[model samples]
Structures are given as C-alpha cells and as structure tokens.
Target: SQTIHQWPATLVQPVGSPLSLECTVEGTSNPNLYWYRQAAGRGLQLLFYSVGIGQISSEVPQNLSASRPQDRQFILSSKKLLLSDSGFYLCAWSGSGNTIYFGEGSWLTVV
Candidate 1:
C-alpha cells in the first residue's frame, strides 16, 4: 500500500533560479526512491535513486541533484535552473523488484 506524493503540480522559473521538488512515500520504509524526467513525449530518464538514507545514485549529470535524508522522503534540487530543464518531473517508489508507481509530477518551465 505504498503511495507517492510530489508537489507544486507545476513550476515556472527563470534561467538562473533555484529549484526544489519534494517527494514522499507513505506506508513503506526504505523503499527505493527514484526521480525521473520526461521531456515532450520522450521516455522516462532516471535522474537519481536512493536505496537508503544518504545513498543516492545519479544516472545523469545535469543541473539537478537528489538527496534522501529520511527513509521515505526524497528531494530534487538545482542551484540554478536552465531552460533545457523544462520537463515533467516524476517521483517513483518501489519496494525491491516490484513495479514502480509514479506521482502526478511537477511540470517545470524555465523562461
């Protein structure tokens, strides 16, 4: 019975503004957390994942970073956003090899 929550629903930032997106999961502890981005019909690309606290694996090097401070809380951040960063930001949760469920996401548009 795990569910994920991601917020702001939508975000608009300038080319150099900072960014923060939060995701949390209830009903599960130490669940694998994932951050993904989909741009204009493209597939989901993994940004980062954490199997446990202070353990984050990043799949791409960009204007983004992820952290896991709690067993079920995850965050995605950027010191300075970019126009190319505009996309659908998704947070996913899975326990072990189970299928992942995604949140509604925060649509980011950098001007």
Candidate 2:
C-alpha cells in the first residue's frame, strides 16, 4: 500500500525565515503527487502537482514553491516565510484525480 511521510509534525517559524517541508511516498510509482494547504477549518487548497520528476504545476502564486526532484519525493520550500504562510501542509498521492490519499501532514505556525 502507498503511504506518505512528512516531518516536524508541528513547526514554529519566525518571519522572514526559510521553510522546507518534505514528503515522500512508498509502495507506488509515478503517482500523481500534490501539495495542499488548509487554513483553519477550510477545505484543502491545491498548491502544486507533479506528473513526473522535475514536472510541477502551480495552482497558486504566493510565498511558496514546490519541487519534485525524484519520482516519489516532493518538496515544498520558501526562502522567506510570512506570517500568512502559516498553515497545515499536506502531501497526497493518487493514481488519478479520481481519488487520493494524504500524509499525516505538518502544522506550521509563523510568528
């Protein structure tokens, strides 16, 4: 079965600092990878998706960016974090857009 892993279950960052969050999947190959951010109780907001290595699509343009270095490794990075950049970061994988499964997620707070 496919599964994802994200670290620092929770994080606190200062304004203007850099941020890097990692996500990887096991048991599957060439999965449709995605990155999402959830604000409070709101629904998931698509940030990026990758069809393959070094291939990414951004759904939003903000203080964030994403990269897919390897087939199953996805990374989210920001050079300068903003207070508004704080939120729940999630990584998901699916064979198709029909359905998806996610990682446990990382909670980030910028102060």
The backbone clash count of each candidate, in order, is 0, 0
Q: How many backbone clashes does candidate 1 have?
A: 0
Model 1's lDDT to the true fold? Answer: 0.92
lDDT of 2 by residue, 1-106 (tens): 7788987689999999999999999998998899999998777899999989999999988999999999999999999999999999999999855589889999
Model 1, residue 17: what's the lDDT? 96
Which residue runs does candidate 2 get wrong by more than 4 Å?
none
Q: Look at candidate 1 and give me any clashing residue pairs.
A: none
- Provide the lDDT at 38 for model 2: 95
| Model 2: colliding residue pairs | none
- Displacement of residue 95 (Cα, Å) in model 1 is 0.5
lDDT of 2 at 86: 90
Q: Compared to the true structure, candidate 1 yields what TM-score?
A: 0.95
Each prediction's TM-score versus the true structure: 0.95, 0.94
Please list the residue runs of candidate 1 whose C-alpha ends up more than 4 Å from where it truly belongs after superposition. Answer: none
